[model samples]
Target: MVDDNKFKALVNKYVELSDQIAEVGAELVALRKKKDAMGELVMQVMQQGDIQVLELTEQGGKLIRRESKRTEALKKEHILDELMLLTGNDATRAQASLEKIHNKRTLVVKDALSRKR
Candidate 1:
């Protein structure tokens, strides 16, 4: 009887925490959208004003404008194109190579909770 009560309590706590996390997750997504929009606006302002750095005297901080490089993830089409090129434009060979690579890659599985509506 005691064990059953304890198990029920743990499950209840887990459900409550999961609910709180989901709510916060939603708020974070909304906040990120707003922040991204504001960031674009700030970038435009900085560009127009020809300002690279803005100092906040009260906040004891400064915002610095900088450029960053981002690399795009490799897609299947890109891989296929490259493989076909390497294989003398042989589609079948390229596909076989792609399949071989995919087969050799490791796969992992883990348990997760799915929220019910």
Candidate 2:
């Protein structure tokens, strides 16, 4: 009886926490959209003005524009093609081998509570 009660309490706590997290997640998505939009606007304004640093005396800070370069992401198709080359251009065998490796990977499971609509 005690164990059952403890389990029930934990499940209730989990649901409550999940609800709070969901609310916060929605707010975070909205905030990120706004931030991205503002960043785009700032980039456009700085580029138009040919400005590197915008000093705000009242705000006591400045915005600096910096450039960055990075390579593209390593996609699944690229990896599969490389694997096919290694497997002597045997696409089917390579795919099967990859699937076997994927299936052998360890997975962790935990108890979770969700609200039913």
Candidate 3:
């Protein structure tokens, strides 16, 4: 009868160890899945950041081009006004026309700059 009790106790101990091992295996699998998901999220965020940087660079280039064009237009307007005054056929009319053109160009340039900001 004592031998029987000892044998049963040994079997119970073996069963308990098996259960603990199974629980640890399940926990390891869960940890692996969470790690994989986190890796994927990091990759997605990096891709989005790259896209945003590219867009910002393109916008900067466009703004530079627009500013250059505006400068050229303003210079041309100034030169034409000076020439018109020197020629002296109808100074008042020429000045008025030049003023109108300059005003329109200035508004367009201001609008573009504002949009960029």
Candidate 4:
């Protein structure tokens, strides 16, 4: 009782949606780049003289600005060195154990012949 025409239409729609997702993702990256540039300018202005908050009045709200320290993560080589020092395990064993704990699964559907260089 499956309608072949309907199934074909659904497949085509799925491919179209995947294409739309790629387009939107690209747009989001572009927007984030612009936002980061603006944020850097704001940060430089804040650091030059201001020591505390600067509130900007808007139509119905305010923009608060402040600074705080962000934690810096150790690099891969440093982390592995520490792990080996603490656990007495070599790189290969540590990686295998981490892989077992970190593995997860997701289902992916790709358009036929869509991936290319």
Candidate 5:
């Protein structure tokens, strides 16, 4: 039956979406932990009685940048996961739905970052 086939397809997509959500959730948690650790380390360095000028080494700068980028990537992945879960009921519509979600998430992050200054 065509209806049965459609139902099966929907179920499969739902399962895949669930798995993606779990993966993204784990990634988000790890990203948060990493960001927190970096923040703590920076705080500890600042709290030291004698702040060494060498603390701001090139390597440290690179590490900070890399961590920032990782956080952004995790956020993007989370948005994608959410999009997939929401659109999983209809395979034909999923791609457009995901693109919209991606654009929205990008704008949201951009706006939030801009407000920090």
Candidate 6:
């Protein structure tokens, strides 16, 4: 003899926990927004003041942030031609090669809520 009351109570508790999870997720999103804003502010201040490292209070850690300015990049449109020129116009017997080697593969998984239409 199974109790209907216990089963219903279990379902109610599950719904309550699901709602709590959503609330916590929202809080996390809000916290991330504030954190990103603070980071941008700190970077702006440092760049404007021509500063590198900013020392904080005794309890706080020092923040060392800098903008990386890329000086040059290999042109992809001229890669084969560039390789051809370097190889003395011989690709089959060329010692140099224009190659892009990927070291690893990454897999991404996303979780989203879908409503039935």
Best by TM-score: 1
Residue 46 of candidate 5: its Cα lDDT? 54
Model 4 root-mean-square deviation? 5.4
Candidate 5 structure quality by residue, lDDT tens digits, 1-117: 469889999877877777787799999999999999987787577557444333457656432222233343456556556666787755446667666665675443443211111
Angstrom error at residue 115, model 1: 2.4
- Determine which window of 10 residues in candidate 4 has minimal summed lDDT: 97-106
Q: State which candidate has the highest lDDT.
A: 1
lDDT of each: 0.92, 0.88, 0.63, 0.71, 0.64, 0.73
List ranges where model 1 is wrong by over 4 Å: none
lDDT of 5: 0.64
Two-way lDDT contest, 4 vs 5, winner:
4
Off by over 4 Å in 2: 76-117
Per-residue CA lDDT of candidate 3, range 5-42, in tens?
89999877877777787799999999999998985675
TM-score of each: 0.87, 0.62, 0.31, 0.55, 0.36, 0.45
Q: What number of backbone clashes does candidate 6 have, counting pairs of residues 3 or more apart or in separate chains?
A: 0
Candidate 1 lDDT over 1-78, as tens digits, reads: 469889999889988999999999999999999999999999999999999999989999998999899999878889
Error of 6 at 98 (Å): 20
Task: Record all residue pairs in model 4 with backbone atoms less than 3 Å apart, i.e. clashing.
Answer: none
Residue pairs clashing in model 2 are: none
Ranking by lDDT: 1, 2, 6, 4, 5, 3
What TM-score does structure 5 among the candidates reach?
0.36
